[model samples]
Target: MRRSVPMQRLDGLVDPRQGLGAAEAQARSARYGLNVIIPGVRSGWRTTLADTLRDPMLWFLLATGALFMLIGSYTEALIMLLALVPLFGMDAYLHRRTQASVEGLSGRLATTARVLRDGSQRTVPAETLVPGDLVLVRSGEFFPADGLIVAGEELQVDESTLTGEAWPVRKQVVEQGLFSHIRETAVEDVYWGMAGTRQLTGHAWLRVTLTGAETLYGEVVRSAVAGPHAQTPLQRSVAHLVKVLIVAAIVFCLALAWLRYHQGHGLVDALLSALTLAIAALPEEFPVVLTFFLGVGVYRLARRRALVRRSLVVESIGRVSCVCSDKTGTLTEGRLRLTHLLPMSNISEQRLQTLAAAASQADSGDPLDEAVLSNCPPPVEQHILARFPFTEDRRKATMVSEQEDGLLVAVKGAPEVVLGLCELPEAERRDWLAAVEAYSNDGHKVIGCAYRTLTSEAWTGANQIGG
Candidate 1:
């Protein structure tokens, strides 16, 4: 029979407990060093020899050098060995440096969480968090421990780091207290670090459900650390060239040995001469040259705000023919700004202010709404009859309110949507459409606004005007 685990309450802050003193927490964190495996000591001679032999370039060079040695060509063998050793060393150094950098990054991350324990709140290193330990999460904080949200209000989380989403996601405690319908067997309500999310607003307590490598951040770290190193295009081309050269050397040696033997020379001496020729043909300095090229390319790309994940991708960028780009954030600022105001009928600044104020107050905190409110003057004192939030699908916001003279209505949304609802002159509408099209083709996102007056008797929800 399976034993049932009790659901832990995730509320309030955990106090520091005796077992988890500051000294212990610091020591634990130090030991984990941001929860990453530190690079161990370098391998000794035997391991180093094994690694060198395993390298493709080193293997090619070794085969060539062995052939030279067999052919009794000491000078060529020495030259090949000298060239191969430095290349092997460069490769080892680069690999170790990359590994060390990743380890250092991992060490900078938080490894534990402060949680409520034993009816008193206490700081617990994430490794010590039990399956049901209550952990507190605050705004502007990274979730060091993974758990289900048990209590929270008005919480917005920026999960873009983990999910690549550009907007904040609102989180709430589900009525069931646990998200059972989610496909993952793990706690459903608990967020993972792979989603790259962080709390934006409000505070809540979570019961520690997963820790260490099992957490979302752990997965991200694993992926980042385990990602394959990209090889440069030149390196690949050189490797291919080396393979062909090795085959050619083998053929040339065989042919030379046959010719020398036919000309009455000893088979052994002929074989030795053939081996020397093979070693001389091998280009062991190619790797060092390739490394220098890759390093230079990476530095140049970094200056352009592009991080070269794979050294080879730098070369690929040069070969790209056509580019498909996103309009938002890539080309434009992505934030809407007020540019112009067009009144349908001639009105004084005071009347325009009255209309702009009513429209601005009805805005629903969007970029366009913020722009409109910024351009409009504040209302003096007025009550709203009805207000509707702007919806991207509807592309409009409508508000009905009472004015000093009579009832008035204001509307704002995408220019095309407002224009379709307006009864403007045909010629003027065509000109406006042409201007809008021109702006759109020039990559400007446009919005339109309209207003109408209403009599008390005819003031109905459906009668609100728009343009």
Candidate 2:
């Protein structure tokens, strides 16, 4: 909440180089409690019970019982209403099961954090972090609290939890005196680093600004956990079925009542008789059966440490056959391994890996680049002088590196695109194309690597030079 950036306010709270002293941090931690969001107080059994009573099937059953009471069938109405007892009890039990499974996961706090204290980096418990703490987060680590990025490498983060998007977001350093990033919601607010988001690719230095409910990630979790969830597919289907059944019951009852009146029966007597028959014809076991089945699913899922926010959603999840993942493809163990390398006859395996690494952004947070860097270090004597980043249309990344002899152009990307960039004999090209096809058939994610020398005529403006 403080408007002062980390450096200017060194006298009171944070020292630019040392962050907060150990004693000062402890006092601040006491002022702001542990960074945990507890939504169970509002979203527990009461909310689930309310949702169950509002269900279409239960609503219809209650309405029918109330109609029986209007017709002076007190004993029958009471019996029908009493039947709801087990339904409510069973729903409550299932709600507890699902809630218990996720409680530990939702309330989990990061056990360790790397922070600057007394002018030296110290590893401490994440929950002890306060607003003024200067934190350093690296690749594959979750941020402990919300803060503003002061400096970092090619930092990228997975913000899918907040945006429901599957792509990595690149973060930029905040220039001095630019305070607009604190409240602004733009994706370009590269200075903002929210708590709980995983840092995908770089070392970042951030000054902690907010924690607990005040942080963006914490707010999202609070709303999702405590508030009413949107209707799921199964809920909609059951409601539609209930509506159709209610309409049919009304139509059949009206016809029966009309026929009775036509046969000279008294109007009131005929109407009462029709209503009774309609009530009896209704399937009283329908609600009981459906609720019982979903309850079983909730119990089973809870045993495996999985929780469905709504019990009815258990049925929806069961119906899934082929689930296509988001644009990033299937999720893995947060790493990638370079399993194979097939190089050209003119190049060795290390040479091929070196060229691929030269084309990649160092610590760019891209899995492909990380895999290549792990395989071989980039040529030590060469460094990129110009870069053309990859895009959907480009399907490749190209870098021009200054070498001792000349400028070396290194490229890596989809095989078809990379092959077009290389000047090879037609026969060799065809043979390589066949090889690519065979490799793809074996389920390998192949990337093409190539290098070429810049011509004397290509020496011109940076952007105008050929890749």
Candidate 3:
């Protein structure tokens, strides 16, 4: 069962028929703040400069430079100090450029949504959305915040970004009124849409329940910010080496100072000699060499149209052996076509496509659904009786259609999930599983589909299919 917190909160605050007044919307916006996901801010140039100066090698160099001046070697001291200027300047430049690039990308991805304010539909920046605001969600838009669906038509959302399941969940009206009006709700009479999920199909009026940091996406963003960052093996190794070098530098400095003092040198002169000795022993050129190699790698990647932001990432990128990418938009073109259909049963390819099409939402704006509908013949004089939309837990959606002969229940989803719902012979199931795996290995997006016909006994009494 789903909690009706969204409905309860929005009940009196927002008017389902009209929406929030202009003055009230402004007040709530001020109270709730912006509905934006604050990204992890990287360290700035000043912080980077401080970190570089604090390095054991840099510390040794600075100490050595001071010793040269103390011993009256003014030229040597000046040269040593000048050597650090270029290194610090280059590092600071890189940090500032990366920061600016990230800011530009973030600005481009910022979205606006159609909202009802003062009973007029208008578009506003998503960050301005607050609780009690009415948002008009349509196909192919990301939900701005968590909200209750006041009104919708065959609404289906793909929450794979949040739940990691590649299926669309249906949202409808709830029977028991969560709000005094707008009764139809979600799965098990709980009507709610989450932030960051894409609306695959349908148009709906959503009354904002939770906004900004109070929403689920906001919670995730906060959790990530609070969590400790995972260190790579290279980073850990480098850190350990730094600690070892710092300890070694201290010991060497102490030993050299004692030896110089025993040889009849003054205390200040002995300390200066020890400092110079320690700095000479340090690998001063190691950082420069590493940065040079990383810069080269970045240039090579840029030639191939890849942007490398951080120099430290070059080593990590080299260690990557495999690259996994999303199929629909990332690797392949946005357009998809159903080229082949392999059915386990005696059903022909045409029949299988027809059944799958019947279950798919034609205008859902989902690529897979659109592909299925495009390949299969258009439905004629068909009456959709009932539908059980897909959920993350169930992983499959079912549709009951009234045909000329009788009622047919169509099911389609991810291969393993849809297979679990049907009863199949062991040998046949094994062969079917093998086929799916074979297709998957060939880089095909395989979808499993199955159907069952009722003889006025099963679906008639139930009048609904449990998803």
Maximum-TM-score candidate = 3
lDDT computed for candidate 2: 0.72
* C-alpha TM-score for every candidate: 0.52, 0.51, 0.57
TM-score of 2: 0.51
RMSD of each: 10.3, 11.0, 9.1
Two-way lDDT contest, 1 vs 2, winner: 2
Any residue pairs clashing in model 3, and if so which?
A: 172-185, 173-184, 173-185, 174-184, 174-185
Q: Which 10-residue window in model 1 sums to the lowest lDDT?
A: 1-10
Q: Which residues of candidate 3, in runs, are more than 4 Å off?
A: 1-11, 39-110, 179-190, 222-272, 283-337, 341-363, 369-467
Better of 2 and 3 by TM-score: 3
Q: Give the TM-score of candidate 3.
A: 0.57
- lDDT tens per residue, model 1, 1-467: 11122232222222212123344435545543432222243545565566556656566666656766776677877877776655555445445545565655455344556676445676655555544455676765656655556567656565544444434465666434233333334433423221224565567666444555655666776776566655556668898887787788789878998999889899877877776666666665675466456556666876786645445566778778999976555665556676655455576655654565576643232344555667675565667888764543565667788878887787766788888888888898998888788878975666666787777788766734643
Q: Candidate 1 regions off by >4 Å?
A: 1-54, 61-109, 164-167, 177-196, 228-238, 261-272, 280-292, 302-306, 321-467
Name the better of 1 and 2 by TM-score: 1
The worst-scoring run of ten residues by lDDT in candidate 2 lies at 1-10
Local accuracy of candidate 2 as per-residue lDDT tens digits, 245-325 = 778888888999998999999899789978887777766556656766877787788788665667767887888899776
Error of 3 at 205 (Å): 1.2
Top-down lDDT ranking: 2, 3, 1
Ranking by TM-score: 3, 1, 2
